[model samples]
Target: EHIKNYSKHIDEFRSQANSQGIWLFISTLGCWSVNIPLIQVIAAILLFCIFIFNSKQDMTEKRAFHKIEEDIAKDIDSNLIGDSRKARLYDLGLVEKYRKAIKPVLKTSPIFIVCYIFYSISFLVFFSNLFPRMKLIFNF
Candidate 1:
């Protein structure tokens, strides 16, 4: 049951992250189209900061979940006795299997940030060329 709940939470986080990414892309595009270098730079920096904050938050939650799982496993190992211990060991094995299955989902990828950086650079180049007045801003 705990594993199920954790899985559900992970799914929710994934959905929220996807939604935020979509909104970030949309807002970035909107700012770019406005052709104001200052606004675009500000929006990009703000959005990147938000992304970093969310990733850190997600990582903290993941650590908390793992701590809970470890505590449960420890309790099963040290607290039970005899027949109940045997039964709980079976359950522990199942828990281990579930943990292995979800391990990949819990990892935070760096590729997303790399892509964001690439996109930002490409736009900076494009903007500098398109708006000569903004060259000072970009160069700075």
Candidate 2:
């Protein structure tokens, strides 16, 4: 039961990370299309910061979930070895169910990384054009 709940929580974080990635891509394109260099620079920086934050959170949650699953498996193994009744309670079917619930969380798609790289390149191009204007405006 607790494992299922934790799985749901992790799933939510994954979903949110994907949603934030999409939003970041859209905002980055919008930033690129806008004529105002200052706004583009500011929005690009902010969106990049958001992307970094979301990525960190997603990684942290996944690591934590993995740790929890490992600990649970260890505990189950120890208990099964120590007691016959507990071993029966922690049967293969129950373990399989837990494994099935967590299987999706373990699988990751690389599309997010591809999208991130694409946006990062776009931002670099956007900034490359804006830097000279910034230099001219600031007399740098």
Candidate 3:
């Protein structure tokens, strides 16, 4: 049961970590999609806020899992029999794999600030409102 909860927490944080990247991608694209700088900035800000919220959630889950892991370790038995023991070991491996997978993203999350800086610079350099010109270009 404890191992199952560990896997669940791992899964939860993995999605949370991925979501931060996904939203940041959308936010970056928003800068290019909209013509008006102010509106683009506003949309980017909102998307970044969502990304930040996910980061916080991921951190919280990480801490919770750590605490749970510590407590579970204290109570785990050395002796176990049959499939129950195999399942517990499998769950432990699964949880560890997910935790490892997300570690790189978490380590570099702050570096994403650099990405936003570059995105803003690009938005300024190539300022185009494609929506307004789409009809003329596409002959709709």
User: Model 2, range 1-140, lDDT digits (tens) per residue?
Assistant: 54555556655665666666677777778877768888878878888887777667655355555666666566566655557536544653464455456455345424454567778777666655557665432332
TM-score against truth, every candidate: 0.47, 0.48, 0.42
- For all candidates in order, the CA lDDT equals 0.61, 0.62, 0.61
Q: Once model 2 is optimally superposed onto the true structure by TM-score, how far is the C-alpha of residue 34 displaced, in angstroms?
A: 2.1
User: Lowest summed lDDT over 10 consecutive residues: which window, candidate 2?
Assistant: 102-111
User: Model 3, stretches more than 4 Å misplaced?
Assistant: 31-50, 57-64, 77-94, 101-140
**For model 2, how many clashes?**
0
Choose 1 or 2, whichever is better by TM-score. Answer: 2
- What does the lDDT read for residue 100 in candidate 2? 56
Query: What is the TM-score (0 to 1) of candidate 1?
Result: 0.47
Which residue pairs show collisions in model 1? none
Q: Cα deviation in Å at residue 132, candidate 2? A: 8.1
Q: For all candidates, what are the clash counts? A: 0, 0, 0
Write candidate 1's Cα lDDT for 11-121 as tens digits.
Answer: 555555555556556655665675666777776677678766775575435555567667666776788788887776677566556556645434432334444555577
Best by lDDT: 2
Q: Candidates ranked by TM-score, best first? A: 2, 1, 3
The RMSD of every model to the true structure, in order and in angstroms, is 7.3, 8.3, 10.4
